[model samples]
Target chain A: MPGKALVITSGKGGVGKTTTTANLGLGLALRGHKVALVDADTGLRNLDVVMGLENRIVYDLVDVIEGNCRLAQALIRDKRTRNLVLLPTAQSKEKDAVKPEQMKELVKQLKDEFDYILIDSPAGIEHGFRNAVAGADEAIIVTTPEVAAVRDADRIIGLLEASGLYDPSLIINRVRPDMVRRGDMMDIDDIIEILAIPLLGVVPDDEGIIISTNRGEPVVLNGRCRSGEAFNNIVRRLEGEEVPFLDMRGDGLLEKLKRLVGLR
Target chain B: MWEFLSRLFGRENEASKVAAKERLRLVLVHDRTTVSPCLLETLKEELLDVISKYMEIDQAGFEVNIEQGDDSMALVANIPIKEMKRALSRTKN
Candidate 1:
């Protein structure tokens, strides 16, 4: 049976697209499904580093596309999970080096060999973003709670719908619960109202995420952290499990007082 | 005390969130339509010019806005006609 191909994208940069790709890919692999993580950013590749497979990148996606290496040879097997593989992008190549048809063909070939193919898209609606989303059956849009991020996500969702990929789910990342409770930051409800997409999961702003990335390890590997649990919920939801969204309301004394006085 | 009381009672008055949503709503209407504010202004000017030839319009009350429907966007124009000059000319003849 053919597997599913999903592209993780955000029209805005630094909204956790690569991190979500690494975690979700590893999360699926840990569930015993053979998964392939494709770093489609081409010139600016970081998925490999996030997955801790950067040092083993002997060949990359461009090598396979240009016939310099076989597809299997370009796939770097993860050290922790044998079922998870990384198809790193060529750091030196430009975004136009690969076309949409080529991406579609490559993902088609990958779908037969793996249970899931997760493409990590680059930021913006330009050639790189187009190349990343070309082959996917579904899309996961990641956004922070900031206004700019949500606005960009809304534009990306419109473009995706125009391209015939409708109903793309959302991942609200880097949410500061305290700020949200204080009405200083946009909450999940506000984001959903603007983006108008189904909720996938919300990842809290975690300092551990920085440490994990620094160590070239995905946060999902720990499972004890808040962001790690969020990624796990995304994985479960992807597998047809109805996982409830995390209640990220920080019930501090001030929050309680505000709620009592109807100031929240 | 008045400000504090208003803040206490207005629980849903999240200034930033409300502002962001309003800004996004207005911007996305233009973004999706690919219509610039300049273009809309030009269009309104041309529409008024063409319509004023046939009737005296309430220029101060005229309004143009892009409204978002369930699945599509519509450019709505409310041109209040004060008097029909063409009808007055016909009546005189």
Candidate 2:
């Protein structure tokens, strides 16, 4: 059976699109499925740095498309796992350097060999976004709880629908449970009501994310943070497993007691 | 006591999230409508001009809005008519 191509995108930048792509791609590969992450952001390539495979990138998407290198030479195998590979993008090329048809053909080839091809799209509704989504069979939108991010997610949903990509799921990132409890931030229901997309999972704003990113390790591999656990659950959901949402309130009596003793 | 308690609880004013939700609601409506205010304004004016030749419409009461629906959107306009104009006499050619 051929694998599915899913694009991870957000209309706004700095909303963790690359982070989610790296985590989800690795999460699926850890489950023994062959996965390939395609960085379609072209000039603004980032999946390499996020995945800690920057130094190993001998070729990129543009090289493969331009026939400068073969497809096998461009794919960088993960240092930790052989099942997952990354097809990095050329940082020096423009967004229009690669055509939509080329991307579609590339993803089609990857689908035959991998269980999942997660295309990490660039931020915006421009050519970069279009090329990234060209060969996608499904789409995952990453957004924060902020107004601008939510609004852009809504706009992306409309654009996706116009292009015949229907019912894209949402992943809300950088959620602050304490702020939500204090009514200082928007809650899950508020965002769901506004965006009206199926909720895949929510990741808390854990400091572990910053540490893991700096260390060039995905949070899912850490396996200690709440955000990592949340990502694991999302992976299960993608595999048709019904995992319950994590308890993010963080105000339970036990937690409060721990906080009192400075054990948190 | 109530005043002091309210102050202490920081409940004297509404939560800022309420305002965020309200603003997002309004903005999403405009975004989803997919029609610019300038375009809508021009359409409203042209519609009024076309309708005025046949009847006297209540210009102050005329309103145009985009009613969003599930899987569809409608351009709804409410133009109140005060009176119909009599047809002008025409000589046979």
What is the TM-score of each predicted model, taking all chains together?
0.79, 0.84
Pairs with backbone N, CA or C atoms under 3 Å apart (clashes), candidate 1: none
State candidate 2's DockQ: 0.46
Query: TM-score: which candidate is best?
Result: 2
User: Residue A60's C-alpha lDDT in candidate 2?
Assistant: 95
lDDT of 2 by residue, A1-264 (tens): 999999999999999999999999999999998999999998988999999999998899999999999998999999989999999999998889899999999999999999999999999999999999899999999999999999999999988887779999999999988878777788899999989899999999999999999988999997767889989999999999999987655567887797588785
> Model 2 off-target regions past 4 Å?
A256-264, B1-7, B12-14, B36-93
C-alpha RMSD over true interface residues, model 2: 1.6
Error of 1 at B84 (Å): 15
lDDT of 1 by residue, A1-264 (tens): 999999999999999999999999999999999999999998999998888888898999999999999999999999999999999999999889999999999999999999999999999999988888899999999999886888789889988886678999999999988778767677888788877889999999989899999998899997767789889999999999999988777657886697588774
Q: Please write out the lDDT profile of model 1 over residues B1-93, one tens digit for every residue.
A: 887886787644567667776776777765668766899899999999878777989999999888877546888999998998855454344
lDDT of 2 by residue, B25-77 (tens): 87887777788789999999999988887789999999998887754578999
